[model samples]
Target: MTFYFHFLSRMTLALISVGLLEACNPKSDTPQQPSGKEKTTKTEMLESGAAILQSDSPLQPMNIYLDGFHAAKDNPAHQMEAHHFCRQVNEDFAQCVLFDGNTRQANLIGIEYIISETLFETLPEEEKQYWHPHNYEILSGQLIAPGIPGIAEKELMKDKMNSYGKTWHVWNSAPFGKTGDKIPLGEAVLEWSFNQDGEALPGLVEKRDQRLGVSTNEKRNDRAELKDLAKPQSGVDALKGKFSMPAHPLPGVVDKKAAGPK
Candidate 1:
């Protein structure tokens, strides 16, 4: 009888302990489904072990995160959101790996290398065609650093003014009106910035804003004081007259050469 009572008490204690543990560490109501393939128990074990054992020194410095939109240079309407995991190489240079989304399941779609105007000027005139200016992206507030304070974001934008980015999209991972390919396909294409209003597909920015809980127009207004820091940038007119709708001018974003002698 005493043995039975002890067993029952132990079982009750175990059940209560499990209930307390579950309450402390609740599972997500909507668990994340990363990638199409489900992770098997073996794969999950291997991944967890590798994470504990592996050294990720190279990836450690990719701390800066920025989200922006991109359009194909050859086809302006082929636009998509780019999440940048960047490493600042120096005062005048930075490099980024572009992803389709901010989540871990996001597809690695492209790369972009940014340089200061001084570095950009040193490039051969022909080489300049591949790079797109950033002033419009900054001033229009389409580019943002999620989770950062507004003041810090604005300061980051100020530093990026007059810079230029050379980008290439290697994967058509997330195309509009179609399911994204499971693997990368097609030739890699040059991507450019939205230099003018109405260039991005309708609802592209809106959908992104809704998902991220941000307002592009609000950021644009907040950065109005930083307008004075913007200098005319190269490639601002690269997509001139490309969109179906008329271009609406954004103040403080200008093409360097266009702003110069006629």
Candidate 2:
């Protein structure tokens, strides 16, 4: 218990320091141009007043921020950068609000609910199809907490090992290098993880890295120690052989069910 509290203290301090430094230069990756009439001065004033008077208790708990990429389950070609503002509900469960960008003008795109492997095992087989495995996301360093210190980020990833996430993207308002729908359109689509290298769209991850001043390769190298914590996860092979290029398996990521008998 002492060690736990000590670690928490260090994490808190690191977050505070990093937050202060990053405030000077905030980064927002996606550029969204949702079709909407410009807000009038009167409307802006009302919003400013509401911000001061309203108690956003529900949103207050959403403290953790993460950036990752997601591809449409049925179509690997459709991919986008996902910014997650998550609230940890418990030791084994979390819920996140997804956005296309990380700034005030960003569009709300979807939601994702995450659960530990233990909690996931309790779900029905039919329901399991909706959840995607997270091992590859973490091990490959495709998921990141942008403004946090390296130690804090690693600890955060360590806690999420072997977890599963069920994500539903409701808006097609912003996609990589293209003018998306003027407004949200069509049915909500299920998003999946990139299980292998060469699966993500070319130049997709690069643009995000350039904008955020982070490196996926560096992150992947730093997280090498966490690989030992990995277990064969479900959905790791769901998009196998789907990419145009020959996909290569990420080290330490495996899908036992997909592998069959040894």
Candidate 3:
């Protein structure tokens, strides 16, 4: 009977030991499954990527170009003019225009130059481009609205190959291999002639002339008249012209007069 009791005691001890081992290594402890909360957080991040791309951060590669004329691009005004020309094409076609120039947004006037791939690569890895790689560099500056200030202004339109929400007015043919080996002088003139026909050339010249306060056409007489009326003169005349006048003068005219006399 004592031997039977001893055997039963040993069996009971063995059973307890097995139960302790099982408790230490729980059956449900197969590597923990991801929590529902964690999965939801990841999903939210994916959905927000698009909005992040369009944000004002310089890193985002929106089509907006700033005035780079203050930087390293050899000629500033000519560069701006080229951008302006493309703007005309973009506007006339009601299509996106690819262009490049002195973009004010960059903060560095003459030192910074923006390129297509450079801008696109600036975007974080998640967002997709509106154009193919080849299509992006070559036709990117093809204006959606002629001379629309890309980064300078915000508006929605199909630009070049991309139906983008906003873009800057500037372009580059060299980086895309459109300009060939020759960094052509007076390329702006050639480009103007190459792309524009009929009255387009005259219109561009007229626009430039107006920008400089030099008239290229007699039709500018109307603009000239408007310019004369917008000037602020002594006391009462200055107040009436500046504040109460119905028709605002063309932009540069007021400044031009202000420089000359009282």
Candidate 4:
């Protein structure tokens, strides 16, 4: 009887101790939440980048209904309801080259999308079979992340200062050994540059930049005419001046293009 009483007392004390401990430090089964300071810090970091990405007119104007520029306009009401939604999302899609200017672990926020079909028709069989848009992978800074001066990774070093510049990082989408067989939705590579007025540098980003496959030797569809001019007149004389170039899908790529408001 004494042993049983002693054991019961000990168990009661243990329970009481546990209750005190829980009272002192409440246990939460839920995931740990960021403190106010931590959340603010994160929000600031994300906002800083999103602001840069949404700083002004996008470097490349989207042809779609809700390209980067039109994001705000598309859902003003929703944006008002959600202060950081569009901004954060836009920045997220744009990709971050470096965290706080660090070059390591480039965070992917956006991509240079091109469909595989376009490349299929444009690229030769050898280049075509291997480079599928879906298989094309992109590095964070290659497209939207700011560019670095002096060191050109994929293409020309024209504005090559070693400072941050923006260019789309183009890649062969093919996974390690597998080649893609379908027409990829995001296929094209683009170079993004901003003008002094904060407008997208159309000539630079769309036509001149090499990262988007625009070089002196390589020209986009519109400039294909210029390519003809560069070629010797022998081929020119045999060919009509007309040349058909691939059309870039407008920027807003959400399905049901006609479904939304105009």
Most accurate candidate by TM-score: 2
**Least accurate stretch of 10 residues (summed lDDT) in model 2?**
1-10
Candidate 1 stretches with Cα past 4 Å from truth are: 1-37
- lDDT (Cα, tens digit) per residue for candidate 1, span 162-223: 89999999988775544666677789999999988888788888977787778999999998
**What lDDT score belongs to each candidate, Candidate 1 first?**
0.78, 0.84, 0.26, 0.23
* lDDT value, residue 254 of candidate 4: 20
For all predicted structures, in order, the TM-scores are 0.83, 0.90, 0.19, 0.17
Order the candidates by TM-score, highest first. Answer: 2, 1, 3, 4
Task: For residue 45, give model 3's deviation from the true position in Å.
Answer: 34
Cα lDDT, model 2, residue 29: 49
Candidate 4: residue 181 Cα off by (Å): 30
> Lowest-lDDT window of 10 residues in candidate 4?
77-86
- What does the lDDT read for residue 45 in candidate 4? 95
Candidate 1 — worst ten consecutive residues by lDDT sum? 24-33
lDDT of 3 at 52: 73
lDDT of 4 by residue, 1-262 (tens): 2232233335435555667523322221211121234347888799889878787654222211101110011111111000000111121121122111111221222232322232234545454222212100111111221121112222221111111212232222221123422222353333222111112212323321332232322322222222221211111111111212222222211212233444
Off by over 4 Å in 3: 1-77, 80-168, 174-215, 229-262
